[model samples]
Target: MSTARQNPLSYDEAVTWIQQFSKSSIPRDQVTASFSRSSGPGGQNVNKVNSKVSLRLQLDRATWIPPHALQKLKTSPLVNKAGELQTTSDRTRSQGKNLQDCYDKLIQAIKQAVTVNRPADLEALAKIEKR
Candidate 1:
């Protein structure tokens, strides 16, 4: 398990956290991948190659994600009732490429979930109150 970032982070801190977290890799033990034959216009290649990759990240096992992000992620469509973040890729005929695509999707989803809107400034609030 990895240390998680705290909630209510400043805008700069959240940006920095996103950058650092994006570069870091998810633990392999927390992710599982399964491959199946792709269903698309590849003719025999699609029929023969099990290139479609289905990646599942067990969110409960990933203690690295911040609590705020995890809470948001739970509402995302990528997560099912099983509390797992599921992604799939059939963009390529190679299993490796498809698997990488799934990883990319997962990473993007997590980053999106972690992003928070900047808080309104106290001065701005005060000015609005004067109206």
Candidate 2:
């Protein structure tokens, strides 16, 4: 179901892809980023530079996402209360790593939205649950 090929994009590649997708599928004003202090390791530098990146996408303002895509995005765990898709990666002290991680997360989110299956009806559930 994914429009993306099976090549398995790297973090940088994924981010570029997401940016392009956003241009076509989401309003420019709907996307934003915030910097925060990263948790978990990284020593003293972590306390100084806010390496964590939070990518937010305001779904309600998006004109590009189809209705079905919007529904899937809403149900996805990636979305927050503000209807923003957030992703953070600070495993490494490097900002590049964190940025790449965020991109990968976004790519995964889109893939999820594109491929999600509808819930089965009660009759279908009954048949499966009976096993």
Candidate 3:
């Protein structure tokens, strides 16, 4: 189900929803969030403050997602060799926004991973191919 999420969705729970097909809460302690100075423009602002947020979820330690969901997510591009879900954002100058962007991106990726096309969708696509 697609919900209009308000700003600052719970980062860890977002990950859970992606793979688990549920919006259960993940423990905050399992997430590792670090901020570093963002690259690119913004002149002095870029050089002065750490605006980029690197949010990492330790997959090995994650217990919130169902077993099947974990297996599916592990196969997605978001998971690295270290079994960590890593994402970073500097889309906005504000660290908070960047953090949210990264989290949103992670959720988006999870949604994509779990998506399945139905027979009706395939038939519609095939009809287009016949054109």
The digit string of per-residue lDDT tens for model 3 on 82-123 reads: 898888898878998888888777666556544443335687
lDDT of 2 by residue, 1-131 (tens): 34453324454554454456732454547767677888858889889988887777787775455445667788888888877777777877777777767776776677555543345779999999999
Q: Which regions in candidate 1 have their CA more than 4 angstroms from the true location? A: 1-6, 121-131
Cα lDDT of candidate 3 equals: 0.70
Candidate with the greatest TM-score versus the true structure: 1
Best candidate according to lDDT:
1
- Alpha carbon lDDT of each predicted model: 0.84, 0.68, 0.70
Candidate 2, lDDT over the whole model? 0.68
TM-score of 2: 0.62
Provide the lowest-lDDT 10-residue window in model 3: 1-10
After best superposition, candidate 3 residue 103: deviation in angstroms? 1.2
Specify the poorest-scoring 10-residue window by lDDT in model 2: 1-10
lDDT of 1 by residue, 10-116 (tens): 67766877898752568988898999999955779997889999999999877787777887888889997899999999987789988888989999998887787
